[model samples]
Target: MFKTNETQMQIHSIRWLKVIDPDQEYITHISTQFSIPRNFIQTALDENASARIQCKQQATLIMTHLPFNTSSKAEQSVSCKSFAVIIKDHLVFIISKHDHPIFDQMIQYVEQGPEHSAEQLADYVYRFLELAADQFIVASKSVNEQISTVEHELLSSIKNKQVFKLLNHNKVLNRIAISLRGNSKVLNLLNDMQVVTGHQAAQHRLLNVMVETDQAQAMAEIHNINLSNLMDAYSAAIENNLSLLVQYLSVYVIIAAIPLGIASLYGMNIPLPLQEQPYALSLLAGLSLLLSVAIVIIFKKRQII
Candidate 1:
């Protein structure tokens, strides 16, 4: 689906074109309409695409991954997806193969008001960038909440299942960290090069985007560190639990060994002092029980059991 929104206020010459899961026909149509390279259109549709920026002629293609809520039945529950914002001539093309909430937010933002064309392109692009950063912040909050929940569950019971879940969360955070960092770098480079220079308002918006990107990068970094630390702490806790279990089994074996030795010695068919006595069987059994009790008491006193 294609959503075309043109500001009637004439504050900006740039019109916004948002595409949702564009098919080949849609890609071809836009490619021909804006003279954008077919490769650019195809790349934007790619889900595995990375964050990047390139300018061709008067058209600039910025392919970046945005943090998204991963509620899909797919294997990955948390990850970033591509969001391409192409500024060509007098229009801005936002492409995505998936219908992302961030894009919906962008759509609402574009349609919410009308501004003069004075610096509409820069304004629109930066606004979308800010929205993307906002998405990252939102995604991180959910991820952190998940991490906290997992941490609580782990504290109650150290299950490897939760470990696997934590691993998935970490993978998600890792992706976010990479995407945020990459996007921030690209935005910083653009700022230094004055890629979106012109109207004071647009420049101010661009500066705001730079700040937003920095904040997003910092957020990603902080969460990644927290997740790493959580993993480390929980991993050690799991190992400690296993070690305690093994210690318990070892103590049990030692206690069992004492009773086994006593039974074996008595079971021997040798002519011993109590072998001729009528109460020899009961006597040996009593001795065995006493020895086992003594061993249990010793272990308990030593706090080894």
Candidate 2:
């Protein structure tokens, strides 16, 4: 059954005895039933509890991180909040600070079981954690695809179309990294729990999940690094292109200035060497053509054109 506290799902579980408050009566009841210390129960019930594994006189009390979706930005962040307690063969409890879709789904599956065993209960918890890992994998894959798309666009000739996409890709990568780190912590906690319980199969499964997650994280990191490098290379290429363009324009400017300078000098209306010669205009034109050809030859020789 689901309980509400301030409009948030207070507790979710299948065959577990859930206690929201560690008050006098609640503590006394759990203590009597489980032969456990009231202090241990109280500590477990603390909302500000840390992830830990504690052994009581009667049961093994474990507090582990459970994944939750708590992102407020375009990129979603994964968060972990305390979830369950396994008190011996008779009792299991799940508590949450808020509604969790993963735990809720586990509850539904457990309810469908005709009878429950301690092994089944443990397996259910493991399955919930595995499912959480699966979600992370899904999110990582989605982000990776997005990065690939953005990288392709950035590499193409359409700079205007790719700029916004690249920015969004970076944002997504950052968010995914945050979520991956969080999920990794939870996965480690789960693996540690399995080790403590001596559940070899669960440990193997958890390790596999961790491996998959690490691969995804690595892919995201590599893509981010590659994209940054590509951007730097593109910027350098653009700078080189601009330098070549400036050099070409400078040569043209010098060539064009020669004609202007000659006209300006002749416009003084003073006597000049070829002012009244019969073939002066033709000779001047011919000299100008030769000079232009010489400039072209110089540029070609220097490999500047």
Tens-place lDDT per residue, model 2, 1-305, is 43332111212332454455444665576678667766666665554456566666756665654445556665444443554455564455554445556655666666766545544555655565566556656655665576566565445342444545555555566555555565566667756655234255545666777786677667667766766666666555556666777898999988877766776776787899888899977877777777887988988998978
Residues 1-305 of candidate 1 have per-residue lDDT tens digits of: 54433222122465667776766776787788778888877888787887788877677888887876657674336678887888777777777777676666766676675763635667777878888888888888888888888888887464698888888888887888788888887787677776665667777877887788778778867888888888888989988888888898998888788768877887788866888899988987788788879988998999988
The estimated TM-scores of all candidates read: 0.79, 0.49
Q: Which predicted model would earn the best lDDT? A: 1
Q: Give me the overall lDDT of model 1.
A: 0.76
True-structure lDDT of candidate 2: 0.60
Candidate 1: residue 167 lDDT (0-100): 84
Residue pairs in candidate 2 whose N, alpha carbon or C atoms collide under 3 angstroms: 16-92
The CA root-mean-square deviation of candidate 2, after full C-alpha superposition on the true structure, stands at 8.2
